[model samples]
Target: MRLETEMNMLQAKIQAGIVKDETVGNTSRFSDANPNLPHFQDDLDIWLTRSERFAESKNWSRDKWSSSLSALLTGRALDCYGRLSSEQAQDYDKVKQALMKRYD
Candidate 1:
């Protein structure tokens, strides 16, 4: 129920043009590059854990980490990533921390 409310609010924001649709778009800059990434499914912590493990399994470099993971984000998670500064967005650790904070 709480999650549904949040989704509705996010949808409303998108419709109002407050949160751009691009922020929640299913396609991302890195999607084509890394098609196997696990997407965020209304749970930041679980998504982050899964993404981190996926990154490790793929041996994704620190440089490519954030972009690769960003490909899988949607809804508020995508918005959180979009809100990051250019430098922060490039560092997976910073991106992770920011996302955890946003969802917390």
Candidate 2:
């Protein structure tokens, strides 16, 4: 229930174009420790939303972000596409677009 509320609040801030990344807190590690299970679009949306906020603090290059994000995924879920190759990962925008296309 708490997580749902947080996500909803974050989504509202995003829709409002606040750009205040401060509101989007990373309560979950969202790394190897926190693996998001992808099944329905709702689940995917949560993960993607988290990913977008997580991407903000990242100063690394796009490839690095992609690889970093890849490391956070698990293959058990049908929508989970394992780790992404550096080349396949490309830039954050491309990767995000692809993910949004698939899971949004």
Candidate 3:
């Protein structure tokens, strides 16, 4: 059948490296929307706003926000995150408050 032949040709192309078969599971929907937290900027307020928006857009839980923000933090912001107690670090509001206090 024509469909079977086309499928075989597609498989052959993939095997030969002529085509890249990127399936849904292997491709990230957010690849193009990669968000980077602003680092060491005077505009901490703006950075926090953008981070919140990014988390919301991704449908990430509030519980996940602190760790995610910590991972993207750099320079003094990273230091601020590091100085938090383990329990405080787990709370996004605590992390945000710490960062604000550090920068303020």
Candidate 4:
């Protein structure tokens, strides 16, 4: 009876260890397979098509096309930044003037 009980306990420990090892192995494999998954962009296809069209329209010179696209993207970013800054400045001035008037 004592020997049987010890054997049963040993078997249970081996089974539990196997289960824990399998779980850890599976989680590591899953994370490795999906590392750095990209965020899905709603207009990804449209953006790709536009980029291709732009490249083709310029006769597909790799350097020139890439440079042109880079410049265009930079200009757009700057324009957006300028607009945001101007709006923020106007709001700040308005608030400041309003506060001055209130105090006066």
Write model 3 residue lDDT over 1-104, tens digit each, in one string.
44543443343233222334366435232331334544436678888998899889878768767755655566677667666666787789998999999889
The per-residue C-alpha lDDT of model 3 at residue 44 equals: 83
What is candidate 4's lDDT per residue for 1-104, written digit by digit as tens? 44543443333233222223465564222211121222223343454356556556546444333223222222222232223322332242332233234334
Compute the lDDT for candidate 2.
Answer: 0.44
Q: What's model 3's overall lDDT?
A: 0.63
lDDT leader? 1
TM-score of 1: 0.65
Task: Give per-residue lDDT, candidate 3, residue 26.
Answer: 50
Please give the distance, in angstroms, between residue 61's alpha carbon in candidate 2 and its true position after superposition. 3.6
Ranking by lDDT: 1, 3, 2, 4
Tell me the TM-score of each prediction against the true structure. 0.65, 0.40, 0.61, 0.25
Worst 10 residues of 3 by lDDT: 25-34
Instruction: Looking at model 2, report the run of 10 residues with the lowest lDDT sum.
Output: 75-84
Best by TM-score: 1
Poorest 10 consecutive residues by lDDT, candidate 4? 28-37
Q: In candidate 2, which residue pairs get closer than 3 Å at backbone N, Cα or C atoms, i.e. clash?
A: none
Model 1 lDDT on a 0 to 1 scale: 0.65
Query: Please, what are the lDDT tens digits per residue for candidate 2 over residues 20-103?
Result: 444675443433322232322346567767765555554434444554454444323223332333344545556566666666
Q: What is each predicted model's overall lDDT from 0 to 1?
A: 0.65, 0.44, 0.63, 0.33
- Give stretches of model 3 more than 4 Å off: 1-40
